[model samples]
Target: MSTEGSVSNDREGHVKTEGERSFWGRLANWGLYQTLMTVITLSPRRQFFILAAFPILWLLTQHLGPMLQMLRVSLLDAYPVAPDVAQEFSLESYFKFFGDPIFWMPLFRTLIFAAVFTLCTLLITYPVAYFLARHVSRKNQMLLLLILLIPFWVGEIVRTYAIMILLGNTGALNLALKWLGLIDRPIPFMYTSFSMGLGMVYLTALYMLLPLYSALEKLPKSYNEAAADLGAGAWSRFRKITLPLTIEGISSGSTLVFLISTGFYATPVLLGGPSTTVFAETIAGFFHVAGDEWPTGAAFAVIMFIVALLITGVFQRLMKSLRKGESS
Candidate 1:
């Protein structure tokens, strides 16, 4: 009788345990279902955001996924993993790059030229942008902006090529020079660093000009007039009023010019002499032309990106300091 009772007790215990597990499982499923229903009942704005984010997320994945894949390939020992070489992660390529003066010299040269180009553009475009913003009538402003945009409508390659022809040995400028008896020879204008710098500025000057115009155009005219009425000289009024207000334009224009000048490769290649070596072109050669050197190229790219980030950060800090000084 006791044995039979114990057997019945065991069966009851098993049934109770099974029932508890079933109840918990149903509870978990109900919680998940409730969460789904709550999401369905979200506010219209929240629902719209959720829906809107899906496409953006998809696009990000599409781009970032490939970039991640490329980054992985760059980190790998070789393109094919080199089964016999015992593959492992290494910074050997970067080490090799940093160890050479050829790499360092070109990089410094590029930075210097890019700085000079940005400075020149800022100086050259500022007057035009200022005139457009302050002095020009509205009708003229519209007409002038349209004219300024004309060069951008034309392709960079075509513009650069046109420049090449104009600066070529037998091109229009040389012919004009010969006609004027300005020089005896064609003037060796075709392949030179000066040509490279000129092309870079010509192609990218609009970027700086437009930003300055945008910032300066929105200023309240009364502020400058008010300052002038208080006996502030024209230069003082400009230094104290116009400049502080248009700081954003200066930052934007400088940054745009700097970024473009640094990243430019084709212009440098087309217009530059053999001695003019920008790191962007060097990076391209390692990836596209050099044999089995893509890893080195990738390393170079990573370094350039970091360097650009650092430089931009420094510029931002400087701009902020200037802004603070003006505010005080």
Candidate 2:
């Protein structure tokens, strides 16, 4: 009786062990979750690449797929008819873009606004960043950055309305002017190029500041000291040493600020005059206002997309040239 009981116990244990193995085998055949966890079963290198590829494939489909479809639409005459009808895919929309000043004028204005906004933000941010990088201690730097980040914690629309309160005719700024007897009437500060530019600067300053601060922080103080020891003037040292190293920051900040500025819709529309219509506003109008002119809108968007690429290419070329000059 004792021998029989021991054999029975060994059989039960073997059956339980097989059940666990079978459960895992079934799980490995299940969908995404199991597959993800099964990465541990893969070799480390293969696991890492698979992990990286997942998000990259997802991003490409999410972002690039729509862009390609838009490009295709831009090449088609989908307006005035169904998008799938007897539409001869041609460059008429593009030619319309080139032929009409109305289409291209927004492009020009967008470029101007982008350039000015980027430049203004750079100028404003550089001094603040330079002071922080060169003067402040590490502990103090964190505190100051925290202070600077407070305003940006709010939403973009909230920040814009805050500017409106400051710049409105009967708003705080005007009230202050009245209190101080600075003017007899409120200045027109809310809806003009000046206001628009100021709004852009306020809205986009951080994009430029962070890069400048990072670049300047990484700069070695020894370069400046060495230049000074060689009797280099302040301006000379800055031009030769300081500026060269910070070029990456400047380019990165400028590119981001300019690209983002070109897409300004609400800020420019609310704060600027009719003359300051930008690419985003135009693109929006084509879709929202004129339902039939979607192809034209698509074409305008494609053109603007190319323009953005051109701006990026210009910056890249400049950076490459700078790198080459440094290398040589």
Candidate 1 local lDDT, 1-328, one digit each (tens): 9978866765675587753345434454587876975786588887778878989898788977776765665675566555577767777777877899888777888888888999899999999999999999999998998998998888888889988998999989999999999998898787788888788889999999999999999999999899888999999999998898888889988988898888988888899987888989888888776456877777777777678768877997899789889979
In candidate 1, clashing pairs total 0
The regions of model 1 sitting more than 4 angstroms off are 1-53, 83-87
* Per-model CA lDDT versus the true structure: 0.83, 0.84
How many Å off is the CA of 187 in candidate 2?
Answer: 1.6
Stretch of 10 with least lDDT, candidate 2: 18-27
Writing each residue's lDDT as its tens digit, candidate 2 over 1-328 gives 9878856765565487753345344455568757777765579888778778979888898889899878878887765566568866888888998797888898988888788888899999999999999999999998998899999888877888888888999989899999999999889887788888989999899999999999999999999999999999999998788787898898898888888888778888788777777878888888887666777898898899788879878986898689668646
